[model samples]
Target chain A: MCSTCGCGGEDASTRVTLVDGPQPHEHPHPHDHTHDHATRTVLLEQDILAKNDLLAAANRHRLAERGITAINLMSSPGSGKTTLLERTVTDLGDRRETLVIEGDQETWLDAERIRSTGRKVVQINTGAGCHLDAEMFGRGLTELAPPDGSLVFVENVGNLVCPALFDLGESARVVIISVTEGADKPAKYPYMFRTADLVLLNKVDLLPYVDFDVDLCLDLIRRLRPDVEMLAVSATRGDGLDAWQSWLADH
Target chain B: MHELAITESIVDAIVEKVGDGPVAAVRLEIGRLSGVVTDSIRFCFGLVAAGTGLDGARLDIDEPSGRAYCRDCRREFALDDPIMLCDCGSADLDILAGQELRIVSVEVR
Candidate 1:
């Protein structure tokens, strides 16, 4: 036994025998016991937008490598987004290479119109989707063959609500609101106005005919987004096109 | 809506964490001010998770209380009301809470 046990014996003295318990049983082979373990509750603390932000960062890196300036244009239906793009492409026709990525629920009419302007254009049909997401814009960029050192204008699907939540790796996001849509638009849809880098008050030529108030609209927009740059223009008549073009050129 | 895309991502995350284990339920903490519609998320979860490992998994949403801080009055209050205002009758406020959209935990076997 060991000196501590006071048995004066070898290793056998160190072992103690059970008094009344059953004999221990031996397993046939060693194996993992995790199969019968209780299910665990894993706490995953993560930001919901973390994955989307990662993809957006990757898109930004790729766009930067090509030296392409992408702008995401958003507005409600009949806000003259397509018309503004038409004017923009024409105004910047020779100064800088321009490409149009038209997003619509259905129809290639916008793309066709842009094509007639002698510019490379691609149309992405979102089907029933309300907005164009980053993945859609990424695929469109690949197919449109966005020229190196060129400006790419992505006209998002006509909607004020859903489009504000998407980040398409655009250098700038421009929100268009027609004068006929009323002056309370900025107040009613503050999210779009808040996220916009520039707000284009289109169809200004129709201000005299319609009941829209340009001053009130501008005031509301200013109240909501104080730092957001704004342009008052009519895409059809090309009124104030020089200012819009100058802003683009500066960027 | 875009909730389908969010659901797909959530399912992917679950699969990554739990592997091929049977997922019994997924619990999400969605706030009222998260900008995500809870009904749309629930509706899309079933559609996106079909045939995947998370198929038939129950979705449990926990809506936490929201709060806002008044800039003018310098007070904090609950955002349970439709209008975000302070007890001092100041409407100018900045949201302090209730913008959470997260998968806090998952029960898997």
Candidate 2:
């Protein structure tokens, strides 16, 4: 049995794979090399996410050099992330070149939705992965390759927890929550709210029909992130979309 | 869930440095506020480390408690999770520690 977590047992094997399926990131080579006979401790004092962070930094540099603006959109499963992207991409139109990178566990549905809006889109299926990390984002960036001074929207997988942990080197992060997701979400998922540069309270048109307290939700989000800018919008009805567009313009 | 991906990174990093040989052990420092579960990583290590130098290697983990400093009250306190609030009833706080996810060392044999 493992001492720390007691996870070791007969059923201990677990598979790790990339978006391409069973291919691991690195394969163990059969190269002959000398092994040290004596045991020696090598001090590495390196952050566990160092590789991801480095790739994210490189991605940031690449985007900056091309004068591109990237926004990472995160939310739960039914937060209207794809609907919002479709509207935003179509509305922006000729004003600014907009592209999208769609991430999901399985399916190109979101990518097809964006493509239908006449925007260049890249679909990344993470298979069993819950979030899109920097490595995957880097691959998407390479495929999309938005033009200079364009806006790139990365629609993250619909999960509030793990998406917040991985930085995709976006210019800003926007967390979208609809009226149906409850007001206490900011408190329940503080990390997601805390890391957001902006929060969008989507589906405002349904607020009158639902029991979502807008003021209380804003208050809770403010408690977690005092400096983050918050907005309300209904992607379907075009309500409060002018402000959302203006915010996008400013960025 | 994400621990499998994390464990893969850990194993790949150590193997890159030490080569595909019999490693003795690896040490990691995991903090409570890092959002990475130690138990999940432990469950994933052996499986992720299987065809590499880290196969059958002992895993040593050091857990650090969450610590935060309240900007409003100028006082330090312990935090159990990511809900950042000071004892002075202030939400404005700076986290000092407990977000670490670091590889401390590796013992090669």
Candidate 3:
């Protein structure tokens, strides 16, 4: 998590701590007497994430110059992003030199899983951070040194909100939602769906067991992003894999 | 949920702008479509502002209603929700305003 924004940090996750007794607190200095200091408002007109955006542009330029297509995968926790990536690399691995940059609060599990597919992988532990910033991606790209013309996939920390505002300099943005979660997922997280170029409805094979209304889901998604493309796929059963692959190939 | 982070940015930006002295107040122009909840930002600012020069400083937010450009209608209109169709019933649109996320200024004494 960014110390400046308090968004990205190992302890960024939601928590409520209970103190056994009263805790000491910082008080304003009485001798400061800074009051009566002429107050003047300075116009800044500066974006809060200006630094992140600048780094994102740099990452974009660097990747574009090398002819690399970077993809940012976003979703809530347990949306099966890693599963989709595993299948994606397994299927598209032969066609392109695939590289995976996995972002997690604290874990090498996703990276190890990607490595098991016999592909290049790097893991970024955000500690308490909820999203992957461009600075982290820049460092990841530099360290991984992906081969020319290769496909780089950044599996952002399982978050829909924070990551939605962050631009990782990816050529494409894909948001995934599992059928088991709910059909209203898109509507519930409009910002996430609104920014995505494509929404991957993952774990479709389990749709029969779950009451996820496909049409309703599509309808809600349409309201948020009328033109955004969607593909229903079962990463485990290999259903609808061809369409997803074709879409990627076209990109 | 991410308000803590934003409040931190607000404090950090004010600190950077003044460098020294006690801040009187901080003003931000938040876009309605920026996805930040004003209530949450306000709630977090108090805690994040403590102990810093900005402590006890007032936080003011200027929120501008979101507006979008409808490609099909070729018209610009206020947008409360991005999915809302234009007057022409076309969903094809590009957001224009309501995405503003910036600090307009800080009053330092």
TM-score of 2: 0.87
- Every candidate's lDDT: 0.78, 0.85, 0.83
Classify candidate 3 by CAPRI docking class. medium
Candidate 2 lDDT over residue span B1-109, tens digit each: 7788888888887776667877778889999888888999999998888878888888999999999999888999998777777867788888888988888777776
Could you report the Cα RMSD, in angstroms, for every candidate shown?
A: 13.8, 10.0, 9.0
Pairs of residues at least 3 apart in sequence or in different chains that clash in candidate 1 = A1-A8, A1-A9
**TM-score of chain B, candidates 1 onward in order:** 0.85, 0.95, 0.91
Residue runs of model 2 more than 4 Å from their true location after superposition: A1-38
Please report how far candidate 1 places residue B6 from its true position, in Å: 2.6
Name the candidate that leads on lDDT: 2
lDDT of 2 by residue, A141-180 (tens): 9999899999999999999988888888889999999999
**B15, model 2: CA deviation in Å?**
0.9
Superposed model 3: Cα runs more than 4 Å off:
A1-35, B73-76
What TM-score goes with each of the models?
0.79, 0.87, 0.85
